[model samples]
Target: MSIVRNIGAEYQPGKGTAFTVWAPKATQVELSLKSNPQTRVPLQREAFGYWTGLSEEAVPGTRYMYHLDGERDRPDPASRFQPEGVHGPSAVVDHTSFGWTDATWQGLPLDQLIIYELHVGTFSAAGTFEGVIEHLPELQDLGITAIEIMPIAQFPGSRNWGYDGVFPFAAQNSYGGPEGLKKLVNACHGHGISVVLDVVYNHMGPEGNYLNEYGHYFTHRYNTPWGDALNFDDAHCDHVRNFFIQNTLTWLRDFHIDALRLDAVHAIYDTGAKHFLQELREHVGQLEEQEGRPFLLIAESDQSDVRLINPINKGGYGLHAQWFDDYHHVIHTLVTGEMEGYFEDYGKPDQLQKALEHTFVYNGLYSEHRKKTLGTDATANPARQFVVCAQNHDQVGNRMLGERLTELVPFEMLKTVAGMILLSPYVPMLFMGEEYGEQNPFLYFVSHTDTDLVEAVRKGRKEEFAYFAAKGEAPDPQSEETFERSKLRRSYTSDPQQQKLREFYKALIQLRKTHPALAHPDKPHLRVKLDSEKLVLHLTHTGQEPHLYCLFNISNQPQKTQLHAAAGPWKPLLHSADTAWGGPGADIPEMLQQRATVSLPPASVLILELFA
Candidate 1:
């Protein structure tokens, strides 16, 4: 494998631009510029199958492509901007052009994060990065410190969930492309909000993928659910790995992204002496040390192994955090009483208690859903290393009708569930429109240009949801109606129930930020007790500042639970069933003595702050 100082199109003011690409299989390569098919500049072959050349006429904003073997024209493999579309030519973008004002900005710590995940295409009426910028103030007002955006890489067409991205470095064309993304990041920093992008490095989208044509980017030896696995451990894999490492650095350095949430890292099959994830983590660490800025990497792994966040010296990958799906599953199953598919093993009340005290309930235990022993112990890791959410893109978009928790459970239960998520020991995340209880479903939608691929996707979606006997044919993935129906309705908050839900979420987040016991991210300091028969859960946090106690009754029956206070009085902080929150039930008493038995309303949560 050959290592180059820099790849892609690097531009200078009067010096024009330099172009470099790796195409070992091709005998020759030429650079085509500015919509002229006849204009071609031959590049000299360098060591290790690399083609390099400098064009005095090519400058920033100049559209170009690489002609392989003087035959077909293809976009740059590391293109920074694909304004026309994925199948169109690449445009040279000036990285230094955007005037960023966040010079002294330092990112927030992992433990202090309150993430709100969103898909740009469906987040607002504009369906662009500019549209998302308008809502950052509201999110910050809601006590969210970080905004986790779904994948934005260039895909086949206009609309997608973004897992089908083919261009690893290019911004999505329909979402205002590169300049728009830079503006969004700049605006976020102005409001003291950090941007965490969800990135997919597991596999490329099948449609309009040209990586294999330029070099051996994909390996046939390994397979993933999407397609062939990326060649991370094969011959000439050094540059392949460098391609991804450089892409990540481009986002952090050029676009000023605070963090990256790696998507489905368990699907990245690599068996080399030096693992790819470790190498990527070291690269990011070096950047952080060099620039003296915070850059976090959160992996989305299903293996349930704590090694993903463990220290590198301790034989681990050293990533900052991982997505905790088990926490969501436990809450979803226990709150909704659904026992099907992967949720078959999680409806028991004890499972939720385990998730509250520890990160995962399936750690080093038998999984009835998988029919095998799954996961390793996670008790040794801190609660900040896990990002827990009650609803996300996968948990809602993959369902038969794309129904949310608001549709499945009662309005009172929604507030109770929100309390459970926001007040937990782990970092909390909320799905788009979840805070306001928006009624529109987040269905899976795509806009692929290929007719054959579109039909195949529709057929596969129907077969995948066939297990749900009550549901019939799913909405067509290619239809415009599917994408339109998924857009978030900002006007829904006018309703009384939705306004109450929004206020309830805001209060919970505020409590999580202010309360001394709830602010900490230590699972060891937390205690959980679950009464399965009465469906009541009691959680306590023993701390020096102000002790905390929370009781939740998931069932629809009012029950009384004893509060075990230490020395002084306990003040009621929040009650989900109170009349102010659109509930018929009355509020809990203002004060409670030690060992007082309090009656909790049906399907409600009571949070108390113990005072000395």
Candidate 2:
């Protein structure tokens, strides 16, 4: 197996450190220590726009910057730790120094992942990497197999969403830096939970961005909503690709991250024979083989393109999975009755049924919102290849008021939605406070220092929400109050209603893991049907003995639905409207026969297990 070499300052034990950087735009590159600016070491320019040098003075914990052409100074683009925010000098870190106890961890399989997404800054009172470790026991007990953290790369300031990260290699200084992140991952592995880091390679943020001064990292050939797209297929693109590919390997090989959630892959434009994602997967596969552990590459894609997850041999970019937003749009619109933006295409009971059955409601269908056809058929993909969620960061935080599902619909409906998501065949992910229903709005917040850039962000947010029905001006994105308000109110978990909801989620997850039919996603044996008149959904899993039948009543009024199961006796497994879940009552019969008429309560869900 070939060892992967990092491009930043690599600490050599007993010796000094070897520093390498790609500075194609500079005529000369010099390393200057922050502790003593007078000390400078000139680096030798190498082939392919790279500069290399050995500096005995530059050791671990030393802060340094590159002096470009004797004119201006800038931080290392691949700095492992930005100790003093994004604008400060970069600090050298020894990757082997941290003591890790997860040598025996084999990592969780893709199908077994029950992901809980959280923002590091707002996940706890401390709002740091170490702060997240305190909640691992609770998350483990809640049956979460993995935690998908939002991006932690150093950004303009502490409060902004990680998508605005400018330094792809450095860990955010405000969130305890590189050491803090390693500790969090170590603790998670000890608790039998995997870690998935969300990384942004689509575009660099406006503030504190210095990549352009180094090399051709961005190209104007294609445009993304965020900013100039990464130069994946433009001039001098090989080095740019290597820069990101090395970044991807560094996270897995050095940091021991189990998986990476590629942010907004739909925005990645590459026309080369071998796509960037494919090359990334190839490199990850090699590393995975060397480490003898599973390393998954999941994408957050808006386009339901099967090519993203298709096998490489079949002329497709091989990926483990992609986020299924069609399910969220269908369920959110169906429950809230909101019909604006992308929600305009959903809001029907059949759409929810189609999403569950085919994995995409807009597969090869014309999108009225886009005024063109969008998405391809994803029905042939494995069920586990699609990650479904009722509410995620983008769904909640991007809203005009950042209102959670708890704030939009009735309390009883919350149970129904949880049941639908948890019991589905696809992998399920829960947002930070959604297990018990967090009430605090996850408002968009930023801490950029540039006044003009801050104003542009404020203006952009207002126009993004113009089509929505939400009234009132959006809270200031640059305000500290907005960041504080987005923090999860952990105290809410103590409330009786919240406690019951938490218990319901725990039970559903337990069942999903233990039940024969639910344990494995046997899509071939799955069936779904919708009764538009009664506003009921019927789902059946007949892959294993003791089949499962799930019924969801989305309307406010109670609805009667016929059982669609083989000849057998059906027993009540879980009912959302039961008294145990703090619902009105359990109106469904205790024992259900095949083809029997079942009465479902308003806005409730019922799961039945059949015995032959």
Worst 10 residues of 1 by lDDT: 1-10
Off by over 4 Å in 2: 1-5, 466-470
Best candidate according to lDDT: 2
Global lDDT of model 2:
0.88
lDDT of 1 by residue, 16-84 (tens): 889988888889999999656678999999877888999888887889999998779999998988888
List clashing residue pairs in candidate 2. Answer: none
293-407 per-residue lDDT for model 2 (tens digits)? 8898999988889998999998778999999999999889888999977789888777877787788888989999888899998888889999989999999998878999999
lDDT (C-alpha, whole model) for all candidates: 0.87, 0.88
Which stretches in model 1 have alpha-carbon errors above 4 Å? Answer: 1-5
Q: Model 2 — TM-score against the truth? A: 0.98
lDDT of 2 at 284: 90
